[model samples]
Target: MTAHLPASGTPGADLGAAVRALPKVLLHDHLDGGLRPATVVDLAAQTGHVLPTTDPEALGRWFVESAASGSLERYLETFAHTVGVLQTADALRRVAREAVLDLAADGVVHAEERYAPEQHQRGGLSLQEVVDAVRGGLDEGMAQARSAGDDIRVTQVLCAMRQGDRADEVAALALANRDAGVVAFDLAGPEEGFPPSRHASAFRTLRDASFPVTVHAGEAAGLASIGDAVHRAGALRLGHGVRIADDVHVGPGGEVRLGRLAHWVRDRRLALEVCPSSNVQTGAARSVAEHPVTMLLRLGFEVTVSTDNRLQSGTSPSRELELLVREAGWTHDDLVAVTVAAARHAFLQEDERRALVDRIVRPAVSPGTARPGRHRA
Candidate 1:
């Protein structure tokens, strides 16, 4: 994380210093979203699952190239290879354990990794068994990080596919594991025809239980879907809430106008989990430079950057921040504000969240400290 001080008056120059060292808080990440290509190939071979390619590097490139089809549906086909290999308890545990270590290595202080338990049950394991396997893996990963003196905390977010009718069951699964490291609930999967309102019963149950929820909205769908997630599903945060920009307009002479939906999102301060590369791959946006994340940040919306799927999109949180700095001209203050906003809005206990802000974010931004540099293991 070598900090490169930007020349005077350069766009994003200040951000290079701040974003590099900032103790990031990640609220939206998928467990199956990130996988080492070699691990995938090995796990596939171990599980006897046939793969499109046996070579690790070729298989990795295949994922990135195949995902360039410019549609979320097409991008998701690459997951068959990953999910196919992650069926057994041992496989699930290894994946989960490695996921935590990877995030820690990437400098994530706290992360919430979501996955659908229902999807991993094809190997004759019950939903509880699946959760236990993942949890055990996470626990082992945490122990390893602690041994290495890396301060990283991880929580699980149980996702129920909006296209399925098992939302209530998934909600119950989350609640069942609430004290066992599960922090929240989510609804993921194709968002076009599957409006979040379809899962109202499950949302109602979670709300009644006083649990936090985030919905994958405004990505494949539009503002109406985001509206349903917040109004009907009670989402505390939004996953890839990029399309909310559809409601924002910029006029001549730098004047900006916000439609009803955009204004509400800004005013409510709901965290928007913006993933730049993933958005481009899914055709949600034209390119990283054209991403609305900058607009939303300038408009005072709570925006937290993320890598929706590292393997598929070929990105990391640091890389995402760097791309925004290079393309969008974000500064150190902007970077600090966004990272702090993510930490502030993380779905963790109040005291734990505060401790992270004070111990990590504050020091990383202090003027006398060394400039942000790459993580050297």
Candidate 2:
């Protein structure tokens, strides 16, 4: 392990620039939730989908403001336009391609972009077709990035909407496409009333096949939802698992005591994909500084930072780290810690993750690693 670096001089413009230049790994980004504003405008025009405004700039503002509603249910409603335009294979392909390029430009070296395949079937495409289109787009973007002197590895995680009834079908689709870049299966959409146990058969099928699993839990709901994801759904990772903080108690002297559930999560080293800006918009946390991610990190839970939805949140992996440094008092060491955690917990095979940490991430953040002098400050 590299020796921890002390806090950089200041946490303003210089720090933001440094954070943006650091290499990053993303584990919880959503495909449908990260379309570029201009792309949305162009696709909506092609599909004859009406929008709040056709101008790309105003449309971007609309998404951010609409999602700013403090209710997760309301925040999700803003996706109607993004998903509406993404019904065609071409639209899905373009969005996936651009998403990869965007993440790469922001210094992300590895990303797993997820989406529910069932959502894109409204245009009469089969699930396999949808997967193929996205894979093609990712390949195109990867090739383009390499030509531009950047290298990135992007993969897919198939999601089954919890509010829908096609978990078994989605699981089968994931299994069929596993070797074709689909790395894992997940349950997304409203986490309040829908528990992962509802799709027990799907999870059992994947487990029997030795497939990896992740679940969106402890975000819109509380401990029971998280418990179901861990014990019943067998999730190797939790999407926005910030609510695990509910089970942790602090004493008058500031000593921390972990409840049984918290102990299980921490002791087992289950990674929590904490998206701070998105969490505040959904009322999951009061602010970035107050978010349980910092406390969870201090208490030894495996905590990783991510941008859950780039478009709606108006953020990237770099911007997400900048916010944490600016508001949560995170040092360079803290940023490096989360980056290492994300790489280790990514849904890759052990050798792949090890290579990513050893060859890419560690070299980027180590002391005296050459970066732009302007960013080094």
Candidate 3:
């Protein structure tokens, strides 16, 4: 079932309002990237760690400015502060719990928050202990949301830093907790030198066990990295697969030429977890208006919008959709379709996915409502 929106002729105010009200799914948010500045300040104070600022707004601005340094290395430095405060079980639980509640407030019905367990071991907690802490927090957060009448489901994606040698260990951890709210395994961190093939053993293990996988590709690197992730790592989704746009050519009369790899990705209906704001901050795209998301959608690619790092990028799922609409002239229908695509590709059981599609995505995109802009072939 697919929901359709009215044409772009609808009033801009109505369009934005409807997009915000639409139930959304987020699959690429990071647990560390969504921390509230006040939470960071409080945690730092409790842990006796010095912060650049105790003021919440200033700290938030510091994170945005630090992440905007135009280099992945600098962008990563911001996480050092965030992870510094997340070294203990209590801290982890607090961050995870608040993250879910925040997503719920943004009208996200489903979300997969990823983080590296290896990063949280500074206080001597084992990998499983870190996982347990986050799980407890998410469970509590979900319960709290339900009691508050906000229906939200959250899952964890255990990420192994590509620069580290713990991919295999992380894969094992994910499999061990498959039934404990751990939904998928991912390879994150610097994507330039640390190719997905470096973690071949981990990918193979996940593949053999049929564990879902998504690799951070096409953001720091280009199509070659995306190719390796798809062919070698068996990635079912491409995290920030923005650079796949490099393979697409806009010909005369608005026709598009898709390279073989791009064609295969689109044809197979593999999800592209595109984060617009983060892409611009990381220089993946020049601007939201210039993002290839519109092109990919027009070309029939399975694209899902996400907030890669809310605090770091200063964005939310609603804000991202709003940016696309205002900057790229997108409509509510487009937002609904993208949200539905995300839910469809979520790392949930088959029956659960179908139920969400029927109950959420379908109703959100019903035809004669404002339809999304059509792409030129």
Candidate 4:
């Protein structure tokens, strides 16, 4: 390992410019949750929809303020305006393009934007149509980023809404387009009553076919939900699996004990998609200072930071990293470690992962630092 950061080091000294320039890989972003506020206004107007605020700044503020309500239900309600405006195929494409551009601007070299194709059918678009439109827009944005000398690649992770019954269909769609741009499958939505086990058939189908799968659990739900995501669904990554912190026991003398489930998670080397700001907005953490990501990292969990819902959380990958630096006092090595781990677990092919590490991640970390190795029980 490289030298430990000095206690008096100014971790966030050059956050805005220096940290923003580092390469990143994002695995938990939502397509609809990352729209530009101005684009949302334009799309709503084009679709004859009513918005809480027409001004871009106010609209953005509304989304952030509403999701900060601390109730999972209320936090999710902020997506209504975004999803409503994205009913049209063109609107979906535009948002997809903007997401790519925004991530590239924040130095994301690789990302998998996940969304439910089922939600965009209100305007008569087939599920496949929404998928294609989004893919096309991402391709356009990637080309533009390349033209601007930004080393970036964006892929799709098709998500099946947990509250619905279309998981199998979405899985099939992901398989059909896997060779093109669809890289993975995920189950995303309210995770309390509707567990990943509810979509066992879909997960079974994907598992038998050896498809990459992730599930949103342990965010709005508890450890059982995360267990179902891992055992029943065969998920390789746990989306917002921060609730595993609940299973940890701390002694007065600074000793830590992990429960069986938490031990299994760590021993298996499963990736935990942790989103700090989004976690706070949804009441997972009272504030960034109390976030469990630092603890999980210290405990040797395969923890990777992300901006789950940039719009609703009023954040970006750069902002998320900066927050950890300023609030949690993360060192440069800490930031580099998180970014490298995310790239390692990305849904890309082995060759792609290698190239990403070489071209984007390695330069961000200093020489002689220990790299994350793939280890499992």
Candidate 5:
């Protein structure tokens, strides 16, 4: 079902307020990609990691500008500084804690933040230590959020860099920590050369263990990569799967047809973690208005909006939804639909997903209470 706001005229300020008040579910946030600008400066100073600028605001702007280079490869190069300072357990904990708090403040009720654990070993810490530290930070952030009257649940999706040869080791790490805090496994990093098939053993391990797996597919690559992710790697979800639109054709008669792969994804309801701003920055789409997410959503794909890299995109879930409302003509209904879809497809068990929708999402977006601008909670 779709929802709509008043059609005549709505101020942007009012629209932004309603979007912020709606409870959000985030499935594609990146821990290392969403660090606070000031925190990055402080951590860089402590670790002696040189940055483009020492000033927090300038560093933040530099990240946005560098990531907006319109090439995914160049966009990813901005991560070196973030990964550079995040080599210590203490650094990971601080970043994780801040990520939860920041998401909660942005009105996210449930979130799955991911990071590549193998990337944090420069400080001589074990993979287990990295997971432990991040889990500790998530716990700490949740506790603090509760004290402040914010209800939020954050968990980890451990990722193995597809370009690296440690997929097997990282898969083992995810399985070992599954019961503790890790909820799923992921294959991340460049997708052009390092296809999901390269991590076949890791996916096998995860599938045998019945652990959830999401792959960074259909972003920098095309249909073949996404095909490999779903068919070969057994991915349950696609990270930045916007490129799946390549398989969808819209005719001049206003009719739409889906290619076999697109049909498979939509028919099976494989969630697409579409981050509009990040997609635009990386040249996946021209802009939010032109992003395939809106079309895919209308076409009945289980589309979910997210802030892939909050810092790099300079976005929040609320902001992403607002962009759709203003640019792509999304209404409150579209916002709520994506939120519920995210909750439904989250890595948690079925009962937990239901509870998240009922206790968090439904109450905020319910009719008569979710009107624009006036529904601040």
Candidate 6:
């Protein structure tokens, strides 16, 4: 029989353990939003940055509730605390490294955690310095994981804030470190007024350089935003492209009709970085079971599950898989499919991605083949 999860939303039985053991790939996670609560409290104290809660537990709770407010502004407000404390190079390194450690513990074989370099320059460090610090942290974290016998590999994605004026600068920064630890360039931050079109020139610069780019669209915005990100911005992957669900219509007899924009994304096999918990927290979906990822997967859209923010969403890749298995009714096969999809779309070289798939992902997902790893709960 095919592996299945328990009926309850909490998959503590075989399903939960199986989910945690699964070799996963994460495409969209934020560095600032995934800090350990105690680390945040310590960093805040060191930086003299006051936070909503000094208690680590309380501060962690605050991030989750605040993000669930459904107002992107309120959700983003939590970042001020995390980012405030992460201005220094050491702080950035710790956060990036620890974030990778956490993902490693979650049994993620490959991950790309992104951050806006422009936001981390308050400590008199140049943008390139910020990139170097974060890259260094990722290297250190992966090394530590390797020491612990956890097979994990991670890379950085340099993000440009949407409301900022440094998209091209960030793109260039990505290029500067592409040979190092950085894998891709992305446009992040609020997606409402400042659409991808606002950074068309920067996107063109990255695309012309043959760099991979993923745009934050279809989360706080709709199809117009998604269309622009794909057509105008040359996004190989879409950050929270959940609103692509808007273009899908179901007929009375159950036939599916996809809009042109949806057709373009689907036909191109563009990966949709679907964050279920964060989507509910942001009102993109009413609940995990109601997530459009269910439809996207059913329709054969290239859907890869991820945790947009670990501290804010209170989730990990394993938790994300548990949620889908318990609520979205996903099976082991489904998880394997998405993991492979993410590896294939990853911004790394073709050989590296194939190695991740063939050696780590494929073997681990097989019935008897095993790949050694660890999971955080």
Q: Which candidate comes out best when scored by lDDT? A: 2
lDDT of 4 by residue, 82-104 (tens): 99999988899899999999998
**What alpha-carbon RMSD in Å does predicted model 6 have with respect to the real structure?**
2.7
Query: Candidate 3: global Cα-lDDT?
Result: 0.88
Global lDDT of each model?
Answer: 0.83, 0.89, 0.88, 0.87, 0.89, 0.87
TM-score of each: 0.93, 0.96, 0.94, 0.94, 0.95, 0.95
Better of 3 and 6 by lDDT: 3
The sequence of per-residue lDDT tens digits that candidate 2 reaches over residues 56-175 is 899888998988898899989988989999888888899999999998888889999999999998989999999999999999999987777678999999999999999999999999
**CA deviation > 4 Å runs, candidate 2:** 1-9, 367-377
Stretches of candidate 4 above 4 Å error? 1-8, 367-377
lDDT of 4 at 109: 80
Candidate 3 off by > 4 Å: 1-6, 9-11, 14-16, 364-377
> Candidate 1, residues 103-157: lDDT per residue as tens digits?
7766677888889999998899899999999999998998898777667788899
What does each candidate score in C-alpha RMSD? 2.7, 3.0, 5.2, 5.3, 2.9, 2.7
- Which residue pairs clash within candidate 5? none
User: By the TM-score metric, which is better: model 1 or model 2?
Assistant: 2
Backbone clash numbers for all candidates listed: 6, 0, 9, 0, 0, 0
Order the candidates by TM-score, highest first — what do you get? Answer: 2, 5, 6, 4, 3, 1
Candidate 6 has what TM-score?
Answer: 0.95
